[model samples]
Target: MVEDYRTHPNLAKIKIVLVETSHPGNIGAVARAMKNMGLSQLVLVNPKEFPSQVASVRASGAADVLNDAQVVASLDDAIADCQVVVGASARMRKVSWPQLDVRQTAQLAMETVSADAQAQVAILFGREDSGLSNAEMDKCHYLAHIPTNPTYSSLNIAAAVQVFVYEFLMATDIKSVHQAEGYRHQLASAEQLEGFYDHLYQALQDIAFLDPSKNARFMRRMRRLFNRSQLDVKEIDILRGILTAAQRQSNQLKTLTQDRD
Candidate 1:
């Protein structure tokens, strides 16, 4: 009966995304790893070499996963529809994201899927050498890490994906009570959040708050704030409405000052 976990419907809602992978073989390896763990959704963002024979050869029997993998031009396009985005990282950034361990990340993924059928969870793996850039990480709601030796902690990208895939399979074994079925609202997608952030930034600039060149990290901090909140669609609309109101007020004040001068 435990083998039934292989056919779990929620697994289909989880997307494993690779960002700018340098080696085609690693993509193939990740595909194989995903298939082995009963997860199939794979997305590649700007891989250096793909649709290559090397990848097909490495995929071995799991060529089906490779064949179906989505190739996208940018990280945004890859994760635009996902409601929850988690970045796999080895090092913490200066502006720390809420970090999750491998097992916890799988739990979060499962909970998100259990809550909403339309929602997708994207687990992002970054470049082999640099991992995810600051910009890519900004799109993530959380950063997840595999516990490794503090002295020597780097992992091959495929290996990290395998670890996560295995954990995701293990997550299926948990009792159904742990599922987050109580969450009823449709959580905001990554693209929607990006739009709201842009509006909020423009409103900030309209009121003479943010200076992008000088205070570049300001928006990053703001992203961290809203991302952790896990805003829903309606919440985003409300916040954007507030920003619009503020922007309109700022414009009217500026017009008044100009008229007086």
Candidate 2:
């Protein structure tokens, strides 16, 4: 009874994010894979190599995908407007996160777009050697892992993307869910979240809760918590206001200390 996702209007809202990619050919291959699955949105974050003829040769006839691809400086920029973000990683970290198999991840991503007409989904694939880092994974609501031979389980970034994209198309059920009229307000974007993080860090520094020189583990954990909460625009504003007030108070306390000294 469900309509084909290939023809679904929301299908266009899905975005593929590649972070710190090394090889140009993988970029081209990813483009080809996306095109094969009727996906067009492609974002590259700090790729080591791009605009190479090797990529063009690999892309074959799917050069249009490469031509239209967005090159960004950071993952935050790439996924700024997306309502949902999923990161693909095979490595397990010390801290546990909500994990999903490729199939469920695809289903969840498709269902998000189906629920809200304005919703955009981002599936993040990381660098060839390391995949996503702990800091990067904190930005994702869920971690998707592709099941492979545990003995030898590495998958190429482009091939992994194709597998997930294919799952998305097959998992989607377009007929059951009706798109909502609109979201009450747009969800806080990754860009906005980055701004919030900067503000929070400054506030923490002002109060001496965090040292500027040392890279702390707590920050990553905090990011994981906030990302899972899915804060909206209003919530972000309130938090920013709180941080500003805290900064002001910290400044006044510092002034008193300096005078006493």
Best-matching candidate per TM-score: 1
Residue pairs with backbone atoms closer than 3 Å in model 1 (clashes): none
TM-score (C-alpha) between model 1 and the true structure: 0.93
Runs off by more than 4 Å, candidate 1: 1-3, 173-182, 211-214
lDDT of each: 0.89, 0.82
- lDDT per residue (tens digit) for residues 1-261 in model 2: 445656867668889999989999999999999888878898999999888899888888889989999999988888888877889986766777778898887777776776656778899999899889877887787888788898998999888999988887776664223345544555677778878988887788778888555535667666778877877789999999999999998899889999999
lDDT score, candidate 2: 0.82
lDDT tens digits by residue: candidate 1, 1-261:
234656788788889999999999999999999999888899999999989999998898999999999999999999999999999997877767889999998888887777777989999999898999988888999999888898999888889999999888888755433244455678899999999998988899899997768665888888889988889999999999999999999999999999999
